[model samples]
Target: MTTYPGMPAAPKKSVLPTIAIACLVIGVLVTGFFVYRIVVTVPGTPQPIEAGMVHLEKEGLTIYASVPVLTPACEAQDASGNDVPLKGPTGSETITINDDTWYVVARSTQPVPAGDYSISCTDDETSATYAAGPKSSVVAFVLSILGAVFSFLIFVGLGATLLTVGAVRKRRGNRPTNTFPGPPGAPSNYSQQPPTTPQQSNTFPAPPPYNPGPNPDRPQDR
Candidate 1:
């Protein structure tokens, strides 16, 4: 049988497309998990205010107050008595439900490295309650959710691009290739021809001159 001793055949398809699909799947799962972590615990348990002073920690510590407490009337300070920077809530829920009706009065969107903290607010009838919790802040929650989504999007985008590249590579890999040249004397375009063999001679040779009993009739000429 004929064979190509010098030709290299096309290789198998690429695995990049498969990798892209897996990446996309993983991205979605991760994004879902992160968002869930931030959302499932809305209005997270917080440190309650005691005697107008509440010790809080973390940057996103959200301050929650009773409906009657004016957000602007509240202030916060650290253990060193230095005023803790506070700003109006941005991109956070105005109200959350925990043990009672609480409104998000103020918060700091900037990463305020608020360590231990104290709160001072006028409780005219001492009927208002206050607390601080990072999870309670809607702004922080939304930002976290957005971060997760953006990460997912980036992964998906890369996956999609890789998948496209893989598809093209696979198509190229699957294409037929010619590794060896055609037979000798073949046209440049190439064409097959049946093999041939030498033909046998047909005519037979004449018998040698009558070799009858040479000495029978003629005397043995010395």
Candidate 2:
């Protein structure tokens, strides 16, 4: 659209809202990731893994050992004595309690209903340190959760601020405006000129008329 000079014009449409939405979506996904981590191990009480029946509060529990369980070397069973499915973890996550360390080994791929289960590992013999669930102190766990929440808020705030600014600019651009005329600009290549005066003639008539009259009177008398 045509616009007048000094007039506010609507800004060009942008993909900022799209970008903001993307940021929000990614933020939620990331936040969910933290939430999942917190949920998986946070609530479970740490119990020593052994050959006999152990009380497990949640399913998909991580199998921990001093060494990695490379295979389905470890397995579990439900309350009814049926063998439960277990899969080794894709990555390593560990926790240390009282200077003793236990690494994750395997977990249930699907949710197992909450109850007691018998945990058995074929190759693991280090019975003293074998354990499952989170071992981090209460303080560290709280900090990690706070960090996730802080990151989520930052992303959401950024998106919301961008959306608000864009909307305000668009509204202002669409609004009608008044522009007061300003003082005229100086002439281009102009300069001040000096004043001009009329010129006078330099020549004047001689006194010859008087001499010619005297000579005429003298000739008449002769």
Residue pairs in collision within model 1: 92-139
Could you tell me the TM-score of candidate 1?
A: 0.50
Name the candidate that leads on lDDT: 1
Q: Candidate 2: RMSD over Cα atoms?
A: 9.1
Candidate 1 residue runs with Cα over 4 Å from true position: 1-44, 60-62, 82-101, 107-115, 125-127, 134-137, 160-222
lDDT of model number 1: 0.67
Local accuracy of candidate 1 as per-residue lDDT tens digits, 1-222: 354675565466678888899889988887887788677535556667676565444455567766645545667776788776777655434554555666676765455564777776555755767777663545567777787888799888889999999878877776766555667776444555689888999989987897655466567832
TM values, all candidates: 0.50, 0.43
lDDT of 2 at 107: 70
